[model samples]
Target chain A: MIKVEWFYWLCGAIFIAVAALTFADGTNAKRYGSGAFWGLLGGAFIYSTFVVHKTAPASVLGLAVIMMALLVATGQLGRGDTTGPSRAEQEAGADRFGNRLFVPALTIPVVVIIFAVGLAKIHVGSEPLLEKSSETLIGLGVASIVAVIIGFVMLRPKSPLAPLSEGRRLLEAIGWAAVLPQMLATLGQLFVAAGVGKQVGRLTEHVLPSGSLFGGVLVYCVGMALFTIIMGNAFGAFPIMTAAIGYPVLVQHFHGNAAAVFAIGMLAGFCGTLCTPMAANFNIVPAALLEMKDKYGPIKAQIPTAIPLLACNVALMYFLAF
Target chain B: MLVLLGVLLVVIGFALRLNPLVVVTVAGIVTGFLGHLSVIAILNAFGNGFATSRSVTLFVLVLPVIGLIERFGLQEQGRRLIARLHALTTGRLLVLYLLIRQISSALGLASINGPAALVRPLIYPMAEGAAERRFGRAIPEAMREKVKGYSASADTVGQFFGEDIFVAIGSILLITGFVDTTYHLKLDALNVALWAIPTAICAYAIHGTRLFLLDRRLDRMAEAAGLTTRPDKADAQEAGR
Candidate 1:
């Protein structure tokens, strides 16, 4: 019967412990790293709980506090030596082109333009820009112009973007990973819209306690976590699992508050994210970015903290959601 | 069947190592066709996916900027900076990066691509420099690689745990909608995000600890290999002679 307030205090204590640990061994870089990691986890748990109670915008602010604390603990934003580059390293980084800023810069606009034109045409909105052939052409024309302008500026022969000849290779390396989110998101949407969620609801109804409110909350949260591990992106697994099990069964049948139940359920999904490699953004990207000798470097670091947090999340959902 | 076809195209394209854009485009087209969509419909879907998630594409813009910074000796600068800070260690630097990454992500700015974008060209070298300064010489290539590995891991842990706290985030919204409709329960996006806090905390602490111990582990491994400072001392003696 631990109250949410007690959980908050415990979270604060975790942060204090982390800060104390850092102060004790701040001079020792390794010890500080360890302290910051633990501190951040404890802080994130407590902070997120507070945020969940607040409005959406406020939650963002809360996240900012967590980031600031982390930054201070890690010593990145704090006082330290800020030196310039060596001549050799600079030369290596340099190219005949002005700089390598073209790739990321160009990527943003390209992605935007593509999205704009697509959204307009899908008729997903009330007003479809492509209602007439002329409008359709006009939309295409605008997108084309934007793309061309960005391409010209960023990819000019003598521009710094010129050195991005390796762009093709880099994209290739990222390969299917780049499209995974889109595919998964779509899959989630389809699962929800197709009555699959309803089917799952029917299946779960018979197995659980008829009116045990706590049991329902526990099932909802734990299920979401397990689904996230399987699907990688919590977003992907959310629709199918929630629609099938959460909505019709937990909220409607059991008479739970929609907002509290859904929000808490998603949080549970994220717990699974910490432990699984399916979430490429979480598991795969780190391995690729770090070029780690071991592909499991991120997962290995995540397990100890992820397990405890998962337990905490289940507890919160049971207590608070109910 | 359309979905299956689309899936097959993606698998084949990837296996063949075809240009990813082309492969995805082809897959999308196949999916659209199988689903009885017109050519325009397929294209529109592609555009729609990109538009709604415009934030995801922001990373593309950041990559070039990061490349530019790195080109100007960002990594070298980071290294020299770390070398001068006698108290700084590789573990501490990485922990700091993890915090920044996690916090930014939680705010729904999950596009904190700088570390992943800059690590290869900047952070890795900087870490190497710091190790060299502390140990009184350049670290071996294996150890240098290990530093790179840990730095990237830190970023992933931070972002993964942090981002779910934001209610408006696509992941949170998606989760909320799913749970409400499926379980026939009324759940709020805030509740899901609120519950995420503890998990994020756990992620930060556990990963932070690993980063802290990383240096000591490397040192032990290096010592066990019996390839420690003797080589450097020998090189110094030869230079002196």
Candidate 2:
């Protein structure tokens, strides 16, 4: 049997090796630096999980691997610098928005989230919601993939995003990364559904103070937000956190509105999207798409906005809810 | 057992990197199997989810329409319209949009697409065009990019602050239920929604002022960029004629 620690070490080694390979390629370096950055980031994350010991290291490593591969495969990092029209220059003509690679890239996380949520909902006999959600996500993924392929075919620029000769190669890279989160999230759901959450709940009840609804809500929201920042997607964090606090304390004992609380709480969690590097889709994609001088330009712009909003959400719960 | 199997299939399928559609379809099949329903039952669930969330689909459809409008002269016309009005600055334009976006969202019409779906395609382009008309070229790419960022930022702020004010929104309902159950406070969704209005108004006002200041800042940047060649009043009058 493979020990978890051994798996971590192996994954860590793989991530570092991949990072080295990416650095070697000049063309790959520019288009997909974010992916390499994430591979290293993932390694750090997996190592940290061992330190924290409160979370699953395998899932964290899994997601990081997927993100790393996707970024590389999609030519997000090492595409040759061809600084086209600036926003001002583009404003001169009609076709200023440029190639919308971010749109398809976005589908990766969205599909992962929907798949995770559907899996969670299914455990509760909300079979219909689960089935529908899965189908919708699948439909969206198919549409996006097909659109991107067709765009590549029709738009066909000379120094294309990927090597046309290696068309299958690009697809394999993206396809590998794309499937990971869905699997991990499902595993997470199963772990939670199969009574891991119940154990977590028991531990929390003994440790936390009684009659501390405020504390509960605070912990839950902050935990969700922080976890999302770490994980990059709130949906990934949702099942685990909700399984622990949301189901046991918030919904079951406290009688909070399950749907509203989860939805808004998740939104509150998404506020972390503005601050963290881990939420590469929100942080890194905009940078890659815009080619900003400062790598953290998107995050810098978002802080002024996200911090106050998080405070408001907390206050909203206290003032409005309580 | 069936539900368990369905869940397992979903987990394994995604792990294998199969097409997301294929993974999901398999998941749906597994779910239906567990529920002791046939293939038709699974298909119906898919239809039902779409039908229930039709509003979201409508929001998606609005994107192409906005794209088409921008394809015409809508954005340029908007910029020309604003440029002629001299009183309108970048900040003022964004602040106005923030208010509109917030108010609409608060009214439970959060379906109105912003930034990526609307502002990027329409509002930012027009604002840039207007800035160019007044300043006469030389706008930096960084500053222009900042404009796009700000446009998206405004939409996000407005949506985040305003949506809670609508009592009917899922967030408000959630808050009420939590309060009622935990502390036994007997709070109403309407109460939570109503209370959110003041906060929403405050958000609008605060964001609006920031937008105004942003306009001043952009104006300075424009001046620094040596884009201060305002169209002559006589020329404007001639153009008007």
Candidate 3:
């Protein structure tokens, strides 16, 4: 059965390719720094494939993470000047391709849907075709490869190296911000393993006044959001908040519906995600991807909606959860 | 309380605008140390966490395809398509995307859309194109930045609230599993998933209204730029000229 490991290998190869391209680019003054950063990331990806299976020691991967961090911390990472087509060429290409240009771009979502919903369960004599643990991620890997091939058939550039070069350009444009998501996810995990949640849970439980349902609901929703902001993911914050106040205070004392309280409570945590750069994937990465002048642009845009939605969540839990 | 020192470090580091990676690494180490973990154990946590979380960064795989198509003018095509549909304002277009993203995610199709795959390459251009067409001139840099922000916001809000209503989603399973195992309460995943609908609808109404208000903001920006009062006249004038 195809597993998620192969996809990591593919990404490792891609990162290596990007590193090679960076090394080859003479225009970037910090090419070595940038190249080393990507190269380290590439090695980590390949190395992680083994680490995940317990085939290798994880400490090496840990050491690599610190080294990559040092590279960025010291102002080593920088972008090359690799660019895409000129404005006139983009216009001409658009006119030439017309609606056809959308085919490969749109295929990603359509094919992901097909594989995720339909092909995920199919078996070849009892071995699942896709890895059960990560069918969606595997589907994403497959969809991207198919999309790139389709792009090649349609665009037909002079060099087969076009994809790598262009991908490198975009990668450099994103710079260190691209990896921030994974790094934050790592931070979230560390937060969990460090018992940070336990500390916070104890504090919240102490602070709450007993038998006040509104106070219980308010603290549960707000604590979930606050803890998620600290941890960078609602998933990490959920069990802590639930255990501290949700189960004992709200559900047991007030007889709140587990479904309504917890479901809306998670959404409340999402509100914190909108407001925090710690939730880098949803906020910071997008700002960088869109090439905005301010990295916090997405976060600023989200706060208005997040605040109101969070208030609504509090109201929903108070009135409906019981 | 002392174990929460890492949390305090994070808040201070971010407030001071230090390098996030460095801040995070230090914070993790300090947190681990306070939690009484050995060096090897800390390293193990770091490595294991990074490895397991690889799924978060899988958008890297799609980069080559996105980069290649972009070089061949995928964004230009999006712009041109939006330009031709003059009636679809930026707000209306984004509201439409919010609905699409929300509904599609509700059906267990969250993987189908994202910042790298859809928003940067397709949605941002279309929204920007709509803004430019509505204003009948190049939009100011600030307005363009706002457009980008709104585009990303729509995707986030839609995905965050919408995906929970799908019973198979991890969040629902987590809710059910935790409640059932911990409290010994028999909870159905469907029941948990179904409760998400009201908040989902509230998210749509709240964010959908914000998006539509964005159109009015753009109109005010256009008027401040001394463009024609009516967008149609501005369009006709640009064309006739």
lDDT of 1 at B86: 30
Candidate 2 chain A, which ten residues in sequence have the lowest lDDT sum? A163-172
Off by over 4 Å in 2: A1-192, A202-210, A251-260, A276-295, B1-87, B103-117, B129-142, B159-209, B216-241
TM-score of chain B of each: 0.57, 0.59, 0.63
lDDT of each: 0.51, 0.49, 0.78
lDDT string for model 1 (A1-322, tens) is 1122342344345344544544465444444544454354345444444444443233343233334334433443221121333567465544333333333333433443344345435553565534322222222223333433454454343454332322222222332343344334333333343334445565566766777776667677777777667645455445545555566666667765565566657666777776787666557676776667777766765666666666766676566555
lDDT of 1 by residue, B134-195 (tens): 45465566676677667666666676677777443456544433333223333344445666
**Best model number under lDDT:** 3
The DockQ assigned to candidate 2 is 0.05
Candidate 3 lDDT at B111 equals: 45
Best by TM-score: 3
Each prediction's DockQ against the real complex: 0.10, 0.05, 0.36
- Descending-DockQ candidate ranking: 3, 1, 2
Docking verdict class for candidate 1? incorrect
Give candidate 3's chain B TM-score: 0.63
Candidate 3 residue pairs in clash (backbone atoms < 3 Å): none
How many clashing residue pairs appear in each of the predictions shown?
A: 63, 13, 0
Best by DockQ: 3
Lowest summed lDDT across 10 adjacent residues in model 3 chain B is found at: B78-87
